[model samples]
Target: MKSSRGILCSAVLLIALLAPQCFAEDWLYTVRKGDTIWGLSHKYLKDPLKFQEIQKYNNVKLDRQLPPGVTLKFPMEYLKFAPAEVSVSAINGEAYFVRRGVRATLNKAHKLVLGDILVTNKNSSVALLFADGSELLLGESSELIFDVQTKWGETGMVDSRVRLMQGSAEGRVEHLRGPGANFEVQTPSAVATVRGTEFRVRLDKEDDGIVFNEVNEGTVSVQLHENKESVKEGYGLITSAKLPLAKPKELLAEPKLVNPRSKYLGHPVTLTWQPIDEAKSYQVELFKDKALTTLVHKAQVSSHQVSLPEVNLGEYSLRLRAIDKDGLQGLNTIHHFTISPVPRSPQLKAFDEQYIAGQPLEFSWEESVSATQYRWQLAKDRQFRNIVTQQELKNNTHQLPEGLPAGTYYWRVAAGNIHGFGQYSTLKRFDVKRPKPPELSLSDKTITTEDTLTVDWQAVPLAEQYLWQVSSDETFSNIVSEGKSQTSHLVLEELPESELYIRVAAHGPYNQGRFSETKSVVVEPEGNGKTAFGIGSILLFILIL
Candidate 1:
């Protein structure tokens, strides 16, 4: 009887040795009927003398009888058999697991067994990590079974296999360097076998039990019934339970921007892109940020171009994607841009006034915000039929070049930036007045004892009156006579006999013209007394005759 009992104890101990143990921690046990402290120590620790230590740790009386349904704590040295299970590495939203027909909510750090079934609710996801550093990510509304096999007394090389019943799953299989090691994901329609690869497998119930497999990093072989295809990186395959496995196809590359490659700030912007192979349509989205979180505009078009309406002015981003015939969207290509309103029209600072000819006309305008330059034009007519001067100036003011003709001129200014020019300001009119001097002439150059002297001048256009001046000095500082006349002729009642100077000028409403050339005249006194007596005798003879 003792021999048989010893053999039974050895078998129990051997079974305990084979099971995994909790690493560096204590264990808890519940007491059952016919459980004594010494018997429990001998069964768990193989040392009956440790019962006194257990009693001291639990504060139990050794002489008293042991009671059933009592809880006892054992140290790590006395406990064995810590089961190996998968761990929940991450969880998003709501997820649950069914282990051995018992349902529980899934959380980070939760352990899962071989037959454990993980389920993700709507908008929920979870990631499972195996001991060999492999990962399986269950997407929303997905169901997966974790089937992992680990070699006894080994540290690595786990055979990882997952059965996806519905929805999508992404896996990153770690490389195993041992014999009889494998990693695979089996769906309802197809099975994906991978080694050290990053892949995604999805099963759609609405698509008649179709399975989609995509490899992102390494090669993945998709097997469906009697047909199989090896999908490389940047490739995908599709299969259905009712049909044969389809060949792998290359994914669509990112689209390139054809227009507005840099910053843009205008209305009705037309965005264009390079077309991709096998693309049925394109989706273009505009965001207010580079991260594409704030959507400003979104549109889908069959062509490769789309026109965006006016939006608020600020920074923005443009994202484009090609849509295949099967409604699958390819990778997104995002480009940044800016939106700014056109600059305001510049306000002219000049007014309708008269300026002298040959003087520089300084044109100025109000400074517009965010304007980089200004454009101005000078025209002779109101309709700009005769453009005299047009220039692009960097500053708010510009000085007209010298020697501009005297006439009525119209001018306007417009503000501009990197985008384009804005509306032109209201037209401003200005006149340059420069009246010519009248040409003066004398009827007689010499006048001796004359009763009257007359000075005449050529008529001047737009001259309301003429000004005549007689001066003794050449510089006309000592004016002997000065008068204004309505006509071009002027009569002097009396004139000095000495050499005299005469000049004329034209007077208009806006300007007083320069003086004309001076004319000189000289006068001589009468002869002596002898010449007077002879003249008296001749006068008497003529009276007699």
Candidate 2:
């Protein structure tokens, strides 16, 4: 009696261990005109003897032929299958997968298999490539487990399945090449399957009962508990774990990006869009490359605008979509904008670094490779509230207009391109000074033909020296003689035979002040033997009128 009890206990334990395999997930097979369990087993199954089990499980009599319309269920474990090929196409930031409790970093060279739980860290992403040309993007802060990866033996069929544990995933599934190929994403609350097209699945973070789903180009069948909903292209739905799935509704329309352009100029990048009627919020994502495999930033904004954090200067890509009241994100539209950093405040190389208020004045600064144009401004106030002159130029130099009068002014320049304008250069304060001419007078003008002549004037406050020129023409265009003097007076001994014009100007280190009024100097030979003027002594007269 003891031996019999032990045998029965062992048999029960064995049956318990074999129960899963005996009643695993079913692989439905439809009967054809000439189909039979024995023939199918002979052709596709490893052993023909399993037909009895199939007959017993499906309650069908063992026969050479079965009805054409009858569909039979067979345990999937009994089918011969091969591992479906899956490869890592891209990985940005950090991503990993665990297999058999052993962690492995995800990379192009790493081999992935069934039961690998893929995880992406914050600000990171991973891209997967499947044998059937389907691609999947595991988003940041997401976890996914590979539940099934099988390629049935030479049957032209492949099945790829994953369980989205948290966060979200995006997929671009190729149209199924042959019948029976399947791509599926599972969540705690829902299971979505697609034969071909673009789709997205995310487990709701705030509500454990809700699972969000969207279909962009193809049909997706979402199964929630006992109810199954067919979500066609351009539609989405939020399903509850326990309740039946409602009909899929049209997704929120894509928002028109406000002033969408291919370039972005400066920091704190602001992206805005026209408000959609039913949209409650917006989703914005920024990528470093056009492939969108490298996620740099992402946000869910309640308003129509989203502000991007400061990033390095380079080309980038933006993905924008609208979110409805149910928190179902709509189809996304990718916008390519190059973060063409406004050129760094150009190194200023201004002329004299001083403001010269006059006509035809020029201001020049350094150039930048990214700048297609430059904005130069001259303002009367340091804050540039009162602009005196401004210009947008393709070159680095700007020529001031003719109307500015002498005054203290400020000027600055900034770089720009098709993308936008950069920050203005450092505030520049240049002083435009127009020095006044000095006062001149002839203190000692009395002279004779044979006596030396002396000309005197008041000392200029800022002048370091005085410049006196002797010219025959009143305009002094043809100067005959010129000399510099430290004192207020100049002694002129040698004089030309003809009448001469004299003028003086105050000279300083910065610039020579305006010239004083011209004077007339005349010499006469009192006697025939005495020359008109000589360094030794001559009678010379300077007349001022």
| CA-lDDT, candidates in order | 0.74, 0.77
lDDT of residue 252 for candidate 2: 82
Runs of candidate 2 with Cα error greater than 4 angstroms are 1-80, 153-156, 264-270, 310-314, 340-342, 345-412, 416-545
1-545 in candidate 1: lDDT tens per residue?
99999999999987655433333534456778787778777666635578888888888885247677887876645432233567777676788999889999988868887678999888677777776788787777889986654432232545567799988887778875443346878888888888888777878658737877777678998888878899898787878888877788776677887855464534446788888878999868776667443445557899988877677777889878776776554556788876556676688885647875655568888998889988899999998889998999899998865635678899988788987876677799888867567777777777655456778888876667888888888988999889889999888866766778989887764447578888887654444256789999999999999
- lDDT (C-alpha) at residue 454 in model 2: 70
Count of steric clashes across candidates, in order: 2, 6
Most accurate candidate by TM-score: 2
Top-scoring candidate (lDDT): 2
Q: Score every model by TM-score.
A: 0.39, 0.56
The alpha-carbon lDDT assigned to residue 162 of candidate 1 equals 74
